[model samples]
Target chain A: MSGNMNLTLKIWRQKNNKAKGELVNYKVADISPDMSFLEMFDVLNEQLITKGDEPVAFDHDCREGICGICSMHINGRPHGPKHGITTCQLHMRSFKDGDTIVVEPWRAQAFPVIKDLAVDRSAFDRIIAAGGYVSVNTGNAQDGNTLPVPKTDADMAFAAAACIGCGACVAACKNASAMLFVSAKVNQLAHLPQGQPERMERVRAMVAQMDKEGFGSCTNTGACEAECPKEISLVNIAAMNRDYLRANLLDSEG
Target chain B: MGVFSFLLKSSIGKKIIMGLTGLFLIIFLVVHCGVNALIFMNDGGVLFNEAAEFMATNILIRTMEIVLFLGILVHIFQGLYLVFENKKARPVSYAMTNGNANSKWYSRSMGLLGTLLLIFLIIHLRHFWYVSRLTNELNANETLFDEMKEVFSLLWVVMVYLLGMISLSYHLMHGFQSAFQTLGWNHKKYTPIISAIGFCYSIIIPLIFSIMPIAFYLGWIK
Candidate 1:
């Protein structure tokens, strides 16, 4: 069906983490169903600019799901109602004419609200900074098969590397736990032979940083897995637990 | 936090304590159920009382009982604390929540079931353990089976016992495998088996417990 629609949006507006936030309503008319959700927002922003009103603030980049920057809770689910796709991928066609849609930021203690529908996700960057990387000498790229990597290990690592570091997992959890996100990072590195030297230290440092970031503990609720835009598995979490336990048991600190 | 403090204060560490205590209690259920099943012989609780006497009198078993009590206390307190910590993790509620989409309702309601089981445990210990172990005034020799008869005679008491067993069953169903998961006992081939064993054990143990009270109330064993 070829039709343009009128839609109402109730967006969360906050000046900063210290400021109080509330839902502010606005309407956009004659929007083509073909426009992406972010594109629809663009139209609304343009309208606000014409009216000399401050444009709504939100985070996005690449317009694709690759970058984890685009984060928003649409109708209570992260990255909007559709599964496996970020908010930028959601199209106006998913909604009906004259329907009201709710948009909010990822509400978690670690992710303080930055502005309207935008949160400060620097905590994730801090976690990654703690132990998300392996030490490799700076040089030309080595041969891919030099480390005798198994196909299964490579496949599993790739699956975990699919995590965009999006804060959606934290937002979807009832406890606001970042286990899924942290596990994805930990498992991805743990599965690779190149990641061996720092495996124990990596898990410990990352978990410590995660806890320091004030994120809640995971209770295996599976919400993070179900809500992850990458569709990451819960097995990553199990793997992280195994690695962490081994690290603790061995007391490895070399 | 220091290393020991980390174990006590950290989320994953608290989960490890929960897993350990839950497994300990699961084993206790086996012994409890095994001895209680002796009443099925219909010999007027002779074997049941004999076994009960050994459990009460045996020095080794007595020592283990204290450990069991400590484990239960830690499990209850830490479990509640975990529930409380998780609640604080999300200080703000979502405008609309669909938590059921990802996990089982029973798994989420573990806190409530544990609280119910705590109440049941208090009443249960007061009924038998308190008298049998705490004091010699219960019976010169007939405390084991006679106490069961007297307790089951009251329909409300029987109902509470049955309700407690029900809560225990649900709690076990989740706790059994969840404890293992938290302890990193996951395996592709073995986890499913562990889950199945937990499921069957949960049902069978509680059912045996429930049957004893019902049997006594109906005068089937007497």
Candidate 2:
């Protein structure tokens, strides 16, 4: 598995959502198995560049899987076949010689293809703008231990905060539901003491924005968690739902 | 939008309706299955008829029938909307799809299962409910159990009922706990217990329902 091998790549080629896309084929020979998946793409791009041809356009940064910019649909699953890892963390060794890999961009309407393998993930940004943060004035720093937060609650909030704003959940979902992504933000704050003041309003507004963005309803298929690079738990969704219900009840009363 | 419209408009809002309506229908199934199971007494439908009469004539239960109909309509309506939205979400088709790895087949095929169940429900209601309550085809003193016997006498009808129950079990397998999850009832200590109860309910309730038709068709009831 550690030897140089030849592989065929069937990548999607679309200038934009308006333009039709097709699977464009390329062959890369003598690839090192130790090379990262994006490195392999780099080699392909280098070849295309030397030949005076257009290089394949895709998104990547912080190849450490943290930035979440390297979003792609490899084969069928998001961020390639391996679980709990981003496309940048994917190595060539996972694939074998002569493997004809099919690569494509996220296909959700909410994440329309921007280029070949990059999608317009601005919908995620819009949802965050709706209310993904606590309202706090910045001045002299408040002590971190001022609230005396519970360790477990802090950890759970950290877990929910691990969402990188990647659109993978939308891509993997059968319904293209953004419940996992929205819930991550919702539950992250739902667990913290500081988040209590705007808890109801945050959940309600974010969900409103998510719906307005044209994402479909979640059916609790659990595919989002299975495909998420951060391994975000489905329990976050339950937390969001709980908050949402209470928020609705309160809103209706007021 | 206002609060109620807001709840009904969002993706999560639509799911809330699906969950709430699904849970409501599940309660109906439990009561229906429990009463239907009474045929096992085999006392020539005397006790079963008494129970059926109480259900049909009781003001409280009669009022609930309207509520149940509304629940079913909302459930079906929201289900269809969710299905359409999901399909539109993924307009570009995958060249090769593998669904088994991520979720159960029943979980993804809920729309198909629900559609089949809708067809079955109409036929079922027409046979017993309409005949028993709406029409004078049977005397007031006549037992509904005898109607069940006559209905299950047909092999095709029994097969339809069994198939409907299969769809129901699969639908409930996902719907039972999914409803709870959508309503945000999932928890660390309680989720496992809820899932186990849902699994058992999905299997046992459908088994009870299918058994009634099977028992009648096979002469086991006699």
Candidate 3:
């Protein structure tokens, strides 16, 4: 193609969690602008394999943006330098022909890098396990209309539920705070009638898990919301705060 | 109680403390600014001294002063604690970060701004609060306003006050709205209004505060 571009990539190459990492440089040529960022990486890996060099290790499950598995802090931004898109959604068109791209894994104490560009985000899975789900007996599905949900409440819950558990919020935050992700989980349930049964306890447990995970406290900088692939609102954080305060102050069970 | 301990221990709980104490300090600034603004009357410190005496002697104000100090201390201690904890969250630093790509510089810089304000507060308290509240060091004839005149006479002191107000401006700019968010007071309809009010408050209060020392130093007020 006439517009095929060549680029320089400085990728963080780490052996394991205990080993030190460094940015190693490589050049990619004749990259099509239509290729997704991950596809571009695939091309680079193919070249490395052909050359008998170890391919750079990164994480990705779905080429589509929904899976939340693809993570790269490209050029100082989580999921590359675009807004409201995951790394898998980022295209080569976002970069110029001569641009130098730097990619690194999400950097946080809770998320130790497993390899070159893959950090163990099991900390997030544990937080979800803590209380991110509602406890309901496994039976036939309850009728949707059985619980009357206000339209506004349903919409708010839906918005909060869009969070795909990607750790971009953590990556983007200067403190590596997971407030945005935790708030999304908390608020998604807090706004639903089914969520009411364990609303207070859920917030408490999830927050305890979040703190235990060694993620930083939020400073309300709105960085997470800005960089979120799902564009999760910071209002979730506020709602989570309200729920947490109520959980601690007004919950009679304690 | 378990709840009290939760408030003291949890991450969200610590932020709630910051937000509540910050709002209290915000209100205190309004009162402090209003009282100090009386010097603008330029009546050789007569009205200003009366207000100052009333503040010192009033039982209600005296009690609130203790509450104010407690609020300030809690705010300071909690802030320092959070800064320490936040630093530990990211053990491995990014090779490059564009924080300005997502949030305002001042929003990310609350700790630094707050530390500057703390330093300013110490100097400010030493200059006026210590002399007026703790000691009989002031000449009997010199009112608190006269003390202000004497203290602001120095170009360096005035410069420090100006720097302090600048820090206060940025700190309040982020803090006012951040407190509301932390307290779970944000709403789509109400938050914009709160943010606008906060923006004006941050600028106006700090501007008035900066003007005080400048007015004294430049003889704009007697």
Candidate 4:
């Protein structure tokens, strides 16, 4: 962590989607190995600004990685080469001195380029808006332990609820598929008693919105899980499928 | 209509559509592969031609073809939609890097490969199915075996079919495991075994189909 090291960066820079983009090269020297990847980028950008170059625009918030805002495709892997860590949490120690890194935005039609390293993720917002929330009458807060939920159900719900909405699953996906993210939301609520009233409507609305947003189908590839900073399970997808099936069947009668 | 509408709206509905339609496609592949395997049975213009013609001209088969088209459309459309949505949901995650060493190769390339298969299907149906419907005399004497052989004779065509089969296999490897899991069939006791079965089916089915064209083109069989 003490020695200075120089690293090469090949970064994708696009003024806009209509404009052609390519990987522009940069070099950094005297970098501490203890610095995170984004922190390293911070060093590089600081150098660029001092030289009158436009600094790289990357999305990040809560460097702790819980916000799911820091998106990057590092050497073709989402969230850099590490597993289960966001870009902000990825430390420079993982890379060798004088190593080269290729950086690009998440590649998918749905995630259009907003800048050099940012994209318009509002489509996800629409899908969430479709049915991501539970409907409850306004009143006093329910007691935390009032519901007699089975341990397994509680565990599964908690696990599903842990999805941080990072686009890593989509970026990691070969087809840019979103099944993991959507499924996590669906599963989180479906497993809980609080999610009952609008369970059917929730699945239906979210799925419709998912389709309307031009996302690809889940082909069951675990790339989403593999690259997920949260390691969200593919099981949520199964749960979503099951809920949708039951919802459709029951709705068919009315 | 409600059932259909429900299918469009729910996660499970999308999944049921995916599962049922996917299984349907799998069965269709089995049957189609079985019929093609007939070419290996007799070394003449008899069995394979008869089967293909029957399948092509039969009322039930035609009805099934229509349904098959519907299934493919739904599968492809829904698949693409979900992929796009997933991409947007997380604006940024991975930094540019090859993080695929930890994941199955099939999982990372299914979409691009599935798109390849779609293109293959279009050309395949056109040359084999649509062309056979033309009233030209050129289309008259072409038997299924002859048409297949003719198609495979082009080295590039055979190559494309080979690539297509590889893509299909990759798709099936992940897809089979997924379809079962979607149906809540994940028994930890049997999940790995089921995954193995799914893997075998993916590889063997496409291998069998890919071989026929290459074998026929190589004149390994009459």
Best by lDDT: 3
Query: If both were scored by DockQ, which would come out higher, candidate 1 or candidate 2?
Result: 2
* A168-248: candidate 4 lDDT, tens digit per residue: 887777657778888888888888788888888898788778767666666566778889999888878777777776776
- How many clashing pairs per prediction, in order? 0, 0, 0, 40
lDDT (10s digit) by residue, model 4, range B16-112:
6777778889989999899889888757657888888788789999899899889889988877766665555444444444645557766666567
Chain A TM-score values for every predicted structure, listed in order = 0.96, 0.95, 0.97, 0.95
lDDT of 4 at B81: 67
- Give lDDT per model, in order: 0.86, 0.88, 0.93, 0.80
- lDDT accuracy of residue A168 in candidate 3: 96
Candidate 2 backbone collisions, by pair = none
lDDT (Cα, tens digit) per residue for candidate 1, span B14-96 = 77888889999999989989998999999988898889889988999999989998999999998888888877777766676
Q: Write the candidate numbers in order of decreasing DockQ.
A: 3, 2, 1, 4
Off by over 4 Å in 4: A11-24, A45-61, A106-130, A137-146, A174-177, A211-215, A252-254, B6-19, B36-167, B178-191, B210-222
Please give the C-alpha DockQ score of model 3: 0.88
Candidate 3 chain A TM-score vs. reference chain A: 0.97
Give the per-residue lDDT of model 1 (tens digit) for A163-246. 999888999887789998998999898987778989999998999899888888877667788888899987888788888877
Fraction of true inter-chain Cα contacts (below 8 Å) kept per model?
A: 0.47, 0.73, 0.87, 0.44
**Which regions of candidate 1 deviate over 4 angstroms?**
A1-8, A25-33, A47-53, A96-100, A252-254, B1-6, B140-142
Clashing pairs in 1: none
TM-score of each: 0.91, 0.95, 0.98, 0.75
List model 3 lDDT by residue over B151-193, tens digit each. 9999999999999999999999999999999999999899999
